[model samples]
Target: MIEIVEKGVTNLELSKHLIKRLNYTQWKRINRFEFAQIF
Candidate 1:
């Protein structure tokens, strides 16, 4: 798996970069983590 944080632009562009690196499984894991944090 790739690191969640990357050295890049500090805006939507960076989000795009990070998203591109994540596979479906990684996305699900991250989504679950964020969901848990909200509860």
Candidate 2:
């Protein structure tokens, strides 16, 4: 039971990291100067 909890936590952390990285990549592809102007 304790091991399962640890695994779940690790999986969640990994998922969060992946999502952050993906968002950063998408953000970088945009024109930063215009991004703020449009948003």
* TM-score winner: 1
Location of the lowest summed lDDT over 10 successive residues in candidate 1: 1-10
lDDT of candidate 2 at residue 38, scale 0 to 100:
45
TM-score of 1: 0.35
Q: Model 1: clashing residue pairs?
A: none
TM-score of each: 0.35, 0.34
TM for candidate 2 is: 0.34
User: What C-alpha lDDT, on a 0 to 100 scale, does residue 33 get in candidate 2?
Assistant: 69
lDDT at residue 8 of model 1 (Cα atoms):
43
* Candidate 2 residue lDDT tens string, 1-39: 355446665644544554576777775685646654542
Q: Which ten residues in a row have the lowest lDDT in candidate 2?
A: 10-19
Q: Who wins the lDDT comparison?
A: 2
The deviation in Å at residue 9 for candidate 1 is 1.8
